[model samples]
Target chain A: MIKTKKIHKEIETLITGAGTILISSHVDPDGDSLGSQLALRRYLVSLGKKVWIVNHGSIPSKYMFLPDIDRIVRIDNFKSEDRFDLAIILECPDPGRTGDVKHLIGANMPMINIDHHPDNSGYGKIAHLDSGASAVAEMLTEYFLEVGYKIDDPAATQLYTAIITDTGRFRFSSTTRKTMEVAGRLIELGADPRYISDNIYYSFSESTMRLIGKVFSKFELFDNGKICLMALDNDMMRLNDFNSADTEGMAEYTLFGRGVIVGGLLKEMGEGSTKISLRSRNSINVGEVAHRYGGGGHNNAAGFQIDLPLKAAQEKILKDLREIVNGTV
Target chain B: MIKTKKIHKEIETLITGAGTILISSHVDPDGDSLGSQLALRRYLVSLGKKVWIVNHGSIPSKYMFLPDIDRIVRIDNFKSEDRFDLAIILECPDPGRTGDVKHLIGANMPMINIDHHPDNSGYGKIAHLDSGASAVAEMLTEYFLEVGYKIDDPAATQLYTAIITDTGRFRFSSTTRKTMEVAGRLIELGADPRYISDNIYYSFSESTMRLIGKVFSKFELFDNGKICLMALDNDMMRLNDFNSADTEGMAEYTLFGRGVIVGGLLKEMGEGSTKISLRSRNSINVGEVAHRYGGGGHNNAAGFQIDLPLKAAQEKILKDLREIVNGTV
Candidate 1:
């Protein structure tokens, strides 16, 4: 018996009692972060509360179509005189995950932390964290429904995007019966699944497509196809006019090959440095490998930056991956 | 005003009264058709009824991991003396859609037609057609739940696959609130979304990945990027050791480029023949264009064959696609 109902009531009371609210989420905001921020902002605005969404990073081009996306402002633009009675941070394990937005909040101001990360730091005054929830938007949607808050069409679409993307279109193990039920309710409230999907997935730029083609064509399999490696050097990025943002979700493509237990994407970040993103299946913990290289993430997906050239980084990572495949690591 | 409950009762009575049953779906079975057939067969088997699933085509390699996929035998294996008292055809608009399996059914045998296609011919003694439904699996899940029939783990998994694939992982316009709710119920009944999605999506062969790379690398955009085209010749297929089945779902990749309203895939068959698969968005009905070439499909997707070389076929289709982009045809 989790006290989820009591937590929801407390969060609701915090929202209603506040006059001015500031909302923020983790940096490098993906679909889940941006969607949850916008959905929560929309709902709070509907309650006639003065609300502002400030984030450390700019919105990605792919997520620009989200409703009220423009409402999110950069942390650099925060005014010193602006005071918030309450702060609602979503999808962040701790205040540091919100990046520079934490500096704008007064030290004594109450913070409402809503997150679904298993490692949430529980730093806020009223923290409502559920690792079982698929996404922060899932937690928010549940709270809204439990407290009888009307989720309008825009808010519903935003939450729907958050759930689908975070749960990998509801195919992730984190997705629950409650996730699907909330998504269904969002649909009833006017979230057009086709419209949102087309905007998020079908709007890839030509450069991104070409980059993907090049990357896929050059992918190499190792350890009898148990380990798959894909690289994006600086030259490939410059040639295709690609940027770091375009490589956001390409890590998943490495695991598409059959019999691939561990997949890695080696990205050359100029100089002698390389960034490696790893994905694994069959209970192989890539996060442990990432930790060995001073990186941290979930068991299935993780990344790290190395002070080595692309070739050197590949060799090092492949050695470890091979050991892991052989069950010797 | 709808009599769905009454229809469910009639279908229930029909199921309970049947001694021996045969389950089948449209030829060239996809996830929805195969899943619906398997789910229905499993449910009937639980009822102590002898149920056999006979299909016209073999299951695709990607769907071989489905629970009890081996239970679905090809039509060639049906014995002459194997007569069934009740024939339940799923996802088929008409008997012809079932191919040779329809020939084995006795003329006087009672047939139950279950489909979600708008063009259903209503060619059964008891037809339950609802175009609004996302998939036949959705309809069956609803029926089973309503009649208090237990959906075992295998049946639930099959139904979940059918719903996800038919709805494009819940991103298609056909998906509705009811679809999500039913999917939630299936999840509660032991459907593992991650396992099903992994088997259905992430099990691509090496040749398939190489083929996709080549296709994506050579894709072309016309008419200010609104029309995108990709081609696969025999030489390319042979070089990659690929077959026709490898091209499954490749048509969707054509529409992935930003601003692409019309997308087409041209495959060079032997003897100077070509087959074209077309996809469109923003209400640009590709079916109408396919009809001009004597092919047929739904509004957003369609296909046809032309008696010309790859280059000539590309030229001819490009001309029509240009006109379609200009709204002239």
Candidate 2:
């Protein structure tokens, strides 16, 4: 466990003393969490420390253009004896989020938590957490600024990615002046916004496009046009070659129509199980409803998985959304 | 002919004086040319004037989304009694440019030349022209500001269309500080940048996706690695249900590799002629070469049509490009 002191001081000591620190994030990570984690790693390296970063999961092929991605450990290819003096975690709010790396980190190194998620429970010995921020990368960005580290390209890109994903590319309510400030800094640091945006939010793989076509072709608008949903059965997902990660931003499509206040994606993950992501563009608390389903997130966007048949889960979720939207329960 | 005296005043005077003004461009109009033409028409209407604009030939379907497209005139629609006080030409550098609507401009009216090509020969009586400007729309933007009319959503959208198309969404060398200033003004005028950008650049029809897939499958890089070409024969076009406008920006795909100095799209436009669009990202003067081949455009991007077999045209063009890149005669 990390030593008790100020989180900023402890992190600095660990990173400086370790000579080499390994930074990591949970599996199937997104821009915000991953960007926060990677930005920290790059910042430390810039200070002359050897930094090792590993993603417990595969990098989204869309983000393959990022710098230092090649250095991020994936297969490890090392004996368990190899050790890191410190492990810094960013964004992921839970200790169980170590994914496959938990087994790897169990025997060696003290872990530190640097997150900005309300759900975080001060899980590590050194927790630098703030839930008020829109993204954990913002916290790290503040840290970097405090330490007099300039916002460089790698740092900017990751920070930009973090902001974009957390703020739904600046369309969500959490987007604030600070969000714009971070984005502007990134742009000044030579982040190709159109390149980043087109790849991240516009362009898609052939299979992903096919899956989107299939899903939208069957989209249903309900509750007097206030709710919109696209459902994908297991068979359709398999046929279209859609990965679980591909559904990452699928909930966003429902917000296109004029009156789709509540939008969601319901995808069958396995037998008697479905994954649901909810998005509310305006005037709805999908988060409260998701909370009822054992999920919690911001008032506008949240998600949960269901261990029930597609139809049954769909019915229950709709009822919960109705209650929340109508202020009945 | 539009007298230079008439050009010295405000925009309203031009709209008022030109009772039945005609606007037209060369065949295969792009977003910049079309956006400027259409936006001027829409703005004139806001001033309570009735105006007529005709495209001498056909405006490719890619530009159909422009504001006043339906009002565009064609050769077949010309009337024997058709007369105008002024004819405003945009981007079209020369009269009788292929299917250009020279027939629609009665001999009695003076034409105003609004263009951004160096080859323009002071074609009209009242010319508001700057070849150094990236797009004709940039000129119209200045006109809009001088007219003292408050910029609105449609105006912003139109201006954005002009800037985006001209700059390759701000990546081309033509993107200047002036372009940025104009864009900033439009954004301040209530232009939803993201909304317009997503619509124009991101939203593609299903047919476009299919066509893109086919194009990728058939794309070819030249032996020298300095040239890339995609040729869509009429047969492939028909099979893919593609429109000529869908081929509008296809040539840009080739500027990707390490040394790809020139990229082109040569399409068999039916009958005996093949249409060609040439793009050189840096240094090469494709426009001068286009003029030599009976076409003219900017220094870096230009187009021409050849009445020859597809293979013959491709070979001739490639030979020329190889010579140009090698600085050989």
TM-score of every candidate: 0.95, 0.62
Give model 1's docking category.
Answer: medium
Candidate 1's C-alpha runs over 4 A off are A292-294, B291-294
Candidate 2 lDDT over residue span B141-249, tens digit each: 8777766666677777777687778867655555454655676566566555555544554344544544554555555667556677877888877776776766677
Candidate 1: tens digits of C-alpha lDDT, residues B251-324: 88899888998999999887699989998886787888897987666677778889999999999999998888
List the lowest-lDDT window of 10 residues for candidate 1 chain B.
B240-249
**Model 2 CA deviation exceeding 4 Å by range:** A1-26, A29-54, A60-329, B1-21, B80-88, B92-99, B102-148, B175-211, B224-226, B239-242, B252-261, B280-285, B298-301, B324-329
Write one digit per residue (lDDT tens) for candidate 1, span A171-202: 77887888899999999998999888888788
lDDT of each: 0.87, 0.69
Task: Return the clash pairs for model 1, or none.
Answer: none
State the local distance difference test value for candidate 1. 0.87
